[model samples]
Target chain A: MLTLQKPHRHVETVIHSEVLIDCRIENLYYGDFRAIRDCDLSIERGKITAFIGPSGCGKSTVLRCMNRMNDLVQGFRIDGQIHFQGQDIYHPSVDPVAVRRHIGMVFQQPNPFAMSIYKNVAFGLKLNRVKDDIPGRVEDALRRAGLWDEVKDKLKSSALALSGGQQQRLCIARAIATEPQVLLMDEPCSALDPIATRRIEELMLQLKERYTIVIVTHNLHQAQRIADKTAFMYVDTSNSSRTGFLVEYADTHRLFNHPQQEYTLQYLRGEFS
Target chain B: MPTPAQSPHVSQSNSMVSNHSKRSPARTSPTFEVSVVSPPSTTDVLVDRGFRGLAYVFAWLTIVLVCTILYEIGGHAFPAIQEYGLSFVTQSTWDANNAQFSVLPEIWGTLSSSLLALAIATFFGVFIAIFLTQDFLTPRVERVFTTIFELLAAIPSVVYGLWGIYIVIPTIRPIATWLHEHLGTIPFFSTPLSGPGLLPASLVLSIMILPTIAAVSRDAISAVPNQLREAAYGLGATRWQVIPGVVLRTASSGIFGAMVLGLGRALGETMALAMLIGNSNQVSLSLFSPANTLAALLANNFPEAGKVEEQALMFAALILLAITLGVNMIGTVIIDRTTRRLTGGTS
Candidate 1:
């Protein structure tokens, strides 16, 4: 977590390298309306974890809670604990900005800032005041996101000029620029075409070599292709609460090939979308 | 476009208006017909055409009014233009006792004082805008402050002049005198405090125009998409960093448009400057020295002027008109451009 927190450096804390982010969300709420309940998930270091669920199942909501992105939302409150690198992210003294610095995010929409491509990618470094080889780091980040070949020549041009795919890639480059340990993507390629989605899936696979990834995807095939671990979630509409909860959590292959919970099996069998 | 529920009845032969749907039918609403659609009446076409013609005339009135003003002022100014040529503007000497007139000093005061006021207003207006938009205050409290700022514009300019005379001048006089006495070497602070001068007039002018700048800037800052703020925060930007770096940068062009619009308002300010600027005809660098603006010149000298003085004042009026119109045109263009750009025009 990057903070102006006194004498505390904003860097990666590696207490247990295996589990980078441990989330045990008892309940999440938007004002009085409870959104999610009873979800305990561990995102391992350097692996792609895909969150697969139907719409309104709080997949994106839980992904956002990992990085404290929901703090910006009005009346958003969470109960229980999400410990990132052994520190409770919801602690009173913890700075959301610091948590965000160490863990970046990519939104469903490809929203590049109203600036040049180079500047969009370099936004994190300049704001975080990272005293490094800035130009070199920018080039590396762009190349890693696989956008350098397309946008390197037009670095100074407006990011808004890029195609949807290129802009999504630019966003990914921007997220990785600050060298965050975990990257939370909420339907990042949902807005892109099939080819663009394929490219991003490949990029995510490559990115997991260095960074932890938790993605919320509606496309189950995408989870089958790229995710090492998969979490299945369903909305409980029985008690008029309409709360979403985790139904199944396991290895992607085992969950798909083997039978577990009846709800999970019914969901996999296309009983209801 | 009217729904069946809106205008429930229709007849084949009737040149009449609706008792319920008194106005012309809407063109946008397309949903929720509780019953069958009404047949089109013949008078509907007539009413629509009539409304269009009326609106056309009203639109043309703006152009007609502008042309009429231009012709009247230009005709009155012809004598002065013939006597002095365009050099009437550049020549500084204005000896009214000798029937000689030039607007160089008035031009200086108009541009310099308005610009200084704009600079001061922009500083405070931007801070006020940021405070209003950033959720520092809740929506209800923010509306209260917004209304208060806007109420500043509702006050008459002469009232501002009165306030300047009674309050603003006296409040700053001690500091003005102290600065003049100690740092008299600097031209800006060289002149001793007086009742009315450029500094006091500009301070009041800044206050007068503050609402315009603050309101427009608040709209601009508020128009910035929330997604941009999220993107910046997701990149680890603190609240302060996101403000100046992302939010301000995104809204800069709109804020510039707000300044330009405020300048248009400031440039044409007449009654206040006439009363509070002390209406002197000399150009001086000191803030405490009295000066004259083109608006003030026209306001002060027009009623009692001889033939040539009236012509010269008309010329100054034409100049002021051109300046304010040109500024408004530029401001409109800038505001339009900012809107399109922020909406993500490709170029």
Candidate 2:
């Protein structure tokens, strides 16, 4: 019953959007269902773009669409254009395996592979054949994710032994080890406590200078504190049946404070169910 | 806390209402109050009645059967036991006219052929199991292959012996000839393959035991948890890495148990060795030459042996039983140690 439709047409400049990821749009499908309809979005480089919405709003679906992670899901199909660094990701000549090597991902749950702590971070590097000086690279990734000192001595221990917070950091370390140009995190801190969430937020702030980050988060406050750009989505339940839509995307302060849409205002006021 | 009194009048009135309902007539309505009776306790019933006494009867029946066999064979061999005085096992030369027989050659032939069979079965059977369990084939193709192999296990030993004599010999003769010419310098194949011998016997026995090793090893490999495979894949480990590093290491102990079971079966095989081993009592290391296995020797010559020869045959039977039972005991120990190691690490 919450619609993110703007009351009237408005134009807001997306700074440096033409130079960043030039994403083209078409409908995306999950079998017979039209999950994302005519979605056209461009992400500015080196800035945090948070996809914010209630449950089943297709925000995460679009986020997965960005990295083509939906290929792992059975019967998932996309009819759209997603470009990374001016390359068509879905082109016939392009290999999804190679695409993943360049665009790294962190999943919703902290899924560090069942391996030694060092090997978990070194997995992508090894796959890409970045052979020499593996230990130093793994240590550097851990340090960047703020997990070095606690896990330095336990490099050979099972990654599953780490706490949930540490495991999430380890996943982040693993994603960055590939030296990817873009990082897509689908709800990175939803499983963590507030303190842990704050640590991840700080890590993200530090990482934005190096990697373009796209995060899908349900926490409005966390998004406000961390995101440079925000995309708000909601269900068009006027028929009490139709799925959802992403109605507005703008700079963080504008999206949270002064919106042109009634639904956006109600959502910001926590009045919409 | 103090108990509050409802006064005697209220208590009496409340009790009267309940009693009135309790006294309602059963003639106009169905009976709602039925008592439940608990079943008799198992222990009490068992204690009241003694065991069926069939167990005691069966136990005594087994003992009597064993005693009957011992009595029959013992009575038959008693004269030889008195005459030979334990020399029947040590002396190898058999002279029917003089009634002098020795079993040393038969014992040597039995051990070498069975051991050679075991070595071949262990090598090839384990290799086959690993190949089938890996992702070398599509799932449907793998299923067909597995079913065919499983059927191989069900083939009777006599049929295997017949096939070995009729089919396998002609097929493998070229390889045997090649080995005789090329690897004949080796002690095991130094002699020419004039006819069936220790090599043929071992090859036949290996074929008989191959199915067992493959089936058991396949079961053990399939029993490895799917989570382990997924975890390895998630680390971007290739098929080879996952198989050797995770799957095989996890299933190694179980495969070893399977191999030992196959070895035990190989040591006791009789008809196949009898048909293929040429039944010659010699201890030559050359595999191309004729030899005899303990089971084959007993099966072929026991019925014709006189009192002295028969007692020596009984000694060979006892030795074969001891070897098999010893192998089973060691297998139990190894399997126990391996299972303990696995459970200790995982749990």
lDDT, residue B57, candidate 1: 100
Model 1 stretches astray by more than 4 angstroms: A1-17, B1-57, B93-95, B329-347
Worst 10 residues of 1 chain A by lDDT: A2-11
lDDT of 1 by residue, A1-273 (tens): 334432222235434348888999999999998999989989988778999888998999999999899998878999999998789999988989889988899999998998888889889989777776888989999999999999878888788888999999999999998888889999999999999999999999988777888999999899999998999998876555668899888889988878487667767877667
DockQ score for candidate 1: 0.28
Q: Give the number of the best model, judged by lDDT.
A: 1
lDDT of 1 by residue, B1-347 (tens): 11112111134113254543555554445553356678778799889999999999999999999899899999999999888887878877777788788998899999889999999999999999999998788789999999999999999999999999999989999999999999999999878878799999999999999999999899989988898889998988888988998888889887998899889889999999998898888889999989999999888887889888999889899889888888788878887777556445774
TM-score of each: 0.88, 0.61
The weakest ten consecutive residues by lDDT in model 1 chain B span B1-10
lDDT for each residue of candidate 2 in B1-347, tens digit (9 for 90 to 100): 11122233356668889997888776656654565577899986886565656677888999999788767656665666667656766766667668776667777877787778878987887777878877677678888988888887788888988888887777767877899899988987788776677887788888788888888988888887764554344444556666766677668788888878888888888888888888776678888888777788789877788766777666666667667778889888887776655443333
Give, for candidate 2 chain A, the lowest lDDT window spanning 10 residues.
A1-10
Q: What is the DockQ of each candidate?
A: 0.28, 0.05
**DockQ of prediction 2:** 0.05
